[model samples]
Target: MNPAAQEPLDPRDRPARLTVGVVGAGRVGPALAAALRLAGHRPVAVSGVSDASVRRAATLLPDVPVVTPAEVLARAELVLLTVPDDALAALVQGLAETGAVRPGQLLLHTSGRYGTKVLDPALRAGALPLALHPAMTFTGTSVDVQRLAGCSFGVTAPEELRLAAEALVIEMGGEAEWIAEESRPLYHAALALGANHLVTLVAQSMELLRAAGVEAPDRMLGPLLGAALDNALRSGDAALTGPVARGDAGTVAAHVEVLREHAPAAVAGYLAMARTTADRALAHGMLKPEMAEDLLDVLADGDSLGDTRGGAGGGAR
Candidate 1:
């Protein structure tokens, strides 16, 4: 028996601060590397291909050298692979095949859709794998460092590496939430549905208001949307309001008709959301089953009503 192997590691003995390398200096990579630097880790090198990325690296990691991906991997103890999700596997495999990734190096990726499985190639090359995805969006600016504070990081790592993963997240001023490896896709989908789709929804709403001749759509929407978002986040289903939540099928029908006539591109989205809202209201006991049926009927009749060329009648009144 190796006596040293049986000895317990002391919690007080913290691991040495790592020399970090960024493989992609896109919006997420440089921002995260900057946060790591603030956390006392050193960002030694970065790889950026685009002109914008090179400019961003200069802004966020001014002292760090811009180098090739292989050089970045070869020089750092902690490697951050922040490329697009589709590009990650190939990059890791290429690094491994080239013998650039070293044994015992910690390799982390900022991909929301992927967990440590995508790092299998690096693992095979004896690198430790961690998946750490920040929940907020980034603009590839220094401001993202402040945004990262108090944000949740969806982390996936082997049980033995959990502490290391969590500690790194903490150092970057983030809260680490362990996500099961199999749940990565679902987790990422939820974030996309909430954040990405919300942006599209808001843009469509602003356009609709502009079509209606509102001079300052943002001024009109700012407070209402902000309150609605805050309520929805704080109260969930209980926060739901508006015609669909109130089970006013006629109001929804009228809205669909107007959108079809004026903003045909938005009608489909409106109908889909109204139907979903009605279903949710019903499930939450906020709407009676009969009222839900009525709402669903209106949503189903949207296309036929669009052909009528008449304003929605008394039901809307």
Candidate 2:
């Protein structure tokens, strides 16, 4: 037998069944632990920062002990720092200062915008830092726990930690996608722009409908909006509709005027987004490239489209 072939594979080179300790047992931590447990990982500990966190941990992950961060670090081979984004750095620093971080351990945080840099202290202590963010919203309910099993998670780490994080993601029943460190912010921003901003947009729409004396707001626009969102997700950018997509300068001007009349505060955001949509429409070949400049100028003026161009034709309202 060859010398290399005769040697046993190093443990680090192969996937190891890890004992996980979830820190910050609020909405995400317990949900993640439950998902991991369902996928065959052991939940060794859960650390909570506040009374609410403690109660949440008890309610969601009663099997796991609610302990201090130090205790969690001591017990778990992989420490998941699922604390609030603002607290992650402090938590890592604190753990390092206390010498709680174990050598040859794994440290992971779930913040979408942050990379492994936040866990530098833990990394310096010989732990490999990984950043894994599930691309799903948590509502702090059993539903969220259930939903986590099928979500897509963004996994980022140094070369040494990449396979380990991917294995964990796979074990959790989530699709693991790698993101480049520099692209993380743009990746996160796109999700926020599409998902988070949709909430605000829907709220605005519901408020407007209610103000217009729609007795059952949900009955009126909820299905319509839901279908639109479904279509957007299914069709991607081809779901672009309304005035800009059709190069309907008249309808576009009319909408700006009406929004200014009825919802003055919405005008700026409306115009800004309209300009962006027009750009997309042009890119999609739905609108002429020449039309984009005029549309942009009209939106930029924000007062009126005095010389608005383009005929209203085939766009969905």
Candidate 3:
């Protein structure tokens, strides 16, 4: 035998190009399959239920056969179960029950909420299980594949299969951050709380700016928000600023009244968030105790806005 042929392959090395399949060609599935294709894997088949998913598959994975879920497992050496988080369990159980999962085949899911435990049925059927969740958001566009470069993947797998998981993430241009199986839920929740809520907060700020007569809210917010985000990432609680952080109770009270008049629906959220901010600032010694009392009272009482209504002008009516 030749010397190279006689050597055993390293477990952490990328596996030879495998035939890939996608069970749900939603925004994430086709994008990941496309990335894998870029890594020299062959996307042999994909299954998509909705018209949108079918179209997306055609866009991101042109020429790959669109087949049934069972057919996808039948033909692929590496199957990506990219269905909605809610439907993943049922789909896996169904696949396992139908004997569709094959021995030694690789089965991966893109769910952040779950680790490999959800793949136990497939595991019992001799399928290799991997939970590789990209921490970045996907737009169902070709850009998502490019975005995967330097992305962080929350990875969980069997001890024996750890290297294989890392290899796949590396192939997709992602750095693997191993998450303990038991910590998956908390890990996912933190992502949702930060990323999802940040979108809501930014949109709300833009709407409020528009109400304040800013002609181009996006332009005004771009640099401010960018710097704020960078500062928060670098300094954590020490980076906090604005009226709440300064313990400016009068300024906050004025804001509450303005919001109550202009955006009554947003008043409750504003109060809740300000209280939380106040708590953090005080705990970190950014807010003096004496300064906190009035701020807490302003945040605690909805009627506190009434005190600031006199200077609110005739437009308040």
lDDT of 2 by residue, 57-122 (tens): 887777789888898888877778998888888989999989888777778899988888888898
- Each candidate's TM vs. the true structure? 0.90, 0.83, 0.90
- Candidate 3: pairs in clash: none
- Relative to the unseen true structure, what is the Cα RMSD of model 2? 6.9
**lDDT string, candidate 3, 1-317, tens digits:** 12442233343443588779999999999999999999999999999988999999999999999999999988887899999899999999999999999777889999999999999999998888999999998899999999999999999999988988898899999999999999999999999988998888889999999988999999999999999999999999999999999999999989888888988877766776787788789889998888888887777665455443223221101
Q: What lDDT would each prediction earn against the true structure?
A: 0.86, 0.77, 0.87
Please state the error at residue 273 of candidate 2 in Å.
Answer: 1.2
Which pairs of residues collide in model 2?
Answer: none
Clashes of 1: 0
- The best-first sequence of candidates by lDDT reads 3, 1, 2
